[model samples]
Target: GLLPAMALLARTLALLAMTLAITAIKVVPLDMARDSFDDQYRGCSPAMMAVLPALHNFEFQVNPLFTQTWVKAEAEWRKRGSPVSPLASPAQAVALMAYTTKDIYKDFNAAVRVAGHSRQEYRNNFHFKTLHFLLTKQCHHVFRGVHDVRFQARRGQKVRFGQFTSTSLSKEVAQKYGTDTIFEVQTCHGVDIQAFSFYLSNQEVLIPPYETFKAVLETNDIGVALFLNLVLFFVHSLDHLGFPKLLPLSPHWKVSSVSPGLNVIVHSSGSFTIL
Candidate 1:
């Protein structure tokens, strides 16, 4: 935990240094995290943008590097008037930075999980909503027609990815992650970030969080569908077991007599119809 925290702090300090160099500012205190944002990232309303900086000094602290990347990317994105690069948008870069910072991402995910649906009901919700928008938008278009390459590994197991995933079109890269005991990832999503990525070759593709996923891939949809499916599954499984059912169940929640299973079919509308 200390190592990760120290790493994030180092990155944050690097970003702050970069900002200071660019602006030629004499002093920028850590408390002024909100002021660290460049004026260029105006894609979101002041209110929405406010949420990010507020995170720095509050209960949830984020890396300043992320905010800087977002600002720079957003400025470039707006100047181009369209998303030319996959990770050009501020939101997209921010998403990547957050994912890179393991601790922050984990904590953010936990908070979002706790908030659940009530978080969405708040029209003013910015932090989680912004991240949701960023990840979902970029993921939807990643790895369009690329054939899934077989890893040397076995059939079913987990493969861990670092902050910036290093992948390649070459099978050798895949083989590095594969093992005799571990199952190869048959289906995965990746994007060529050579244009935007630093010090990376064109042959390397960055594997995002949704790489192993086949369906309900978008982060937003997955979270909602998974939660709903679990709740419904738990209720129906109990009903089948002849246990006392919980009250305040949604009328729209169609209860089944089937045993607990996670066979959820997510529609394009982000609604899951479990069977």
Candidate 2:
């Protein structure tokens, strides 16, 4: 009986990885999509222990294609004297891909909103926690002065962007999402991923999922005010009942502008980062 249960769990994980890989390149309508890929595996039951291994399997299946394309992009950026974010390690790239592309088959913008909101309860989720660690730790550098665009009109809300959200060095890309109503977001924790996203041109800066921001500034522009928010990044040292410690941030290394485009970034790292 126990062996059969284990086999079933294995099958479930494999199915999940395969479906995610399909969504990576397929196109689906927003009306037919789930909020987040992780929604199906939220509660931490005993079988939930298999999630990390499943993520590892996902990475292994996808890394060859990702790295083959990414290495060329990394070299190109290096030649241009604008290197990719140090946080865009091979493993981290896959994590971001899983989260960002999970709903890519649906409407991209709607996918982002749903994924970010759905991740609010993922603090205990092994996939997200590993992603958090990769962005906050392991990379050895702190990110500051990143920008993003949101379609929502959250002028006075205390916001917790609950997933690996994409930001950028270029305001032009942020401005593209809105015509009359736009929410311009400025924060301090973003990793440059132009290298990892070889197929994209946007100088993508990714905000880690483990921080809090309070909308502090709103301009008088016609439905196009800049919502500059100060962000504080923190890390949990223990799993259960652990206090959060604020991560150190650098005053420098903020990119003001880059080549223009738009892209959404999200997801988790590999087995090494997973518990």
Candidate 3:
């Protein structure tokens, strides 16, 4: 009898240890969980990660196709011995794209559709049309001082074809733009960079921008932590009730082994039946 009693006691202790272990295992650390969430949210592809830095750098350079008109104009400016303002860099282009209203792109495309015939004409038309839109938007802060740079254009000539000279923006000109607008332009630049990288390396997977990914991670962290804590609470409650060790008694009996030669008899009915 003494041997059986000791064996039962050892089995109860083992069951309690197992419950504790389960609870411990499910208790995820906040930082580790957040990191995991971020990785999943971003769809952290090795390929994308490898190329992200280079892509960001590329954003600071002008796209050849987009800036071809500006290039042509800059060459003439150089020939005239005037200081040439650089074409909108890639980051500036994307920032303009992001900040510009959708109607401008739509109208430009429509105009190109109507008047564009040859490939060269289509390319030139797009560049010229985009140049007009950029000028009209007056996104000087997005382009920095590039907008203030004046060019000498003949009557009816597009601004890109003129001899240009770089100039600094006056305080009055700078005061016209708000800090928030500049911040928005910068934010859009970052979004475009993320979009470009996603398209280049992860076309199949939909990866969100970094800011969106962070927001999703923060939201998921709270939910995951709550769920894990709830589970831990349930397990602790079960352990307190002596679950898997103590059971209800009934006429219909079920036997479980607590230890070798130690049996726990439980009944489905509301009665305690211990053997």
Candidate 4:
């Protein structure tokens, strides 16, 4: 199992390097990723302005996650008295909103434009945004801004050391079980901690205003949304079963109840096909 994990990790790095090797072969243009950003409005936060535009560039980083930083973040989180693991996810978005304090609404207007909400109370409390700033606090949290894909993948990597014995289980059984196969596809995640305003209207240019600071995210919502939708849609459209149900459990990972197949895509479109 470790072998597969390690090999997969290697493949990821290789894919990234490959992309950088031949950037000219890109499929989607930049316009889709950076939609809605106007040229005249620069991102209000200096940190965001620098990082958001370069989401595709792995080399550039205004913030990086390292041991020292994560230690500081955990400490600060403790200081803030945040829950051990925040109860926030797409499914529990309502719960996340309930946990939202009044302070997150400081820049209500900025949030409304990007998100379609203006009211302070029901306004969108981006788990992605709040989590972003929380990590960037003075405490020097280890996690970098949401803009870094490598940083996020590192955070998501799990090295479990318990018994992971797989029963000959079933080449037949596994294949049969997947009869209900619901999903199979690639996944890519990119985070830009600084969600800058390429073009902010006169009203939004004002900081501390509701318009200037849109709610922050725990990760890059735009990228995640795009990545998941792209992959899920691609896989689900072909399968008769509707999209895989979101596992009632596991907020940190994407869960799809799909039949297992030879094709599997890991983080950043790094995939392996058994056939």
- Best model number under TM-score: 2
lDDT of 2: 0.38
List the lowest-lDDT window of 10 residues for candidate 3: 229-238
Better of 3 and 4 by lDDT: 3
- Show model 3 residue runs off by greater than 4 Å: 1-100, 114-116, 119-275
**Model 3 Cα lDDT, one tens digit per residue, 120-139:** 33323333333322221121
Predictions in order: lDDT: 0.33, 0.38, 0.27, 0.23
By TM-score, how accurate is candidate 3? 0.15
Query: Which model is ahead, 1 or 2, in terms of lDDT?
Result: 2
Each prediction's TM-score versus the true structure: 0.30, 0.40, 0.15, 0.16
Error of 1 at 114 (Å): 7.6
lDDT of model 3 at position 214:
12
Q: By summed lDDT, which 10 consecutive residues of candidate 2 come out lowest?
A: 257-266
Cα lDDT of model 1 by residue, 150-209, tens digit = 122122222222112344454444344432111212223445544433323324455433
For candidate 1, the 10 contiguous residues with the lowest summed lDDT are 228-237
- Candidate 4, residue 238: how far the Cα is off, in Å: 29
- Specify the poorest-scoring 10-residue window by lDDT in model 4: 160-169
Model 4 error, position 96 (Å): 16
Ranking of models by TM-score: 2, 1, 4, 3
Candidate with the larger TM-score of 3 and 4: 4
Comparing 2 and 3 on TM-score, the stronger one: 2
Each model's Cα RMSD: 19.6, 20.2, 36.5, 25.4
Better of 1 and 4 by TM-score: 1
Instruction: Judge candidate 2 at residue 54 and give its lDDT.
Output: 49
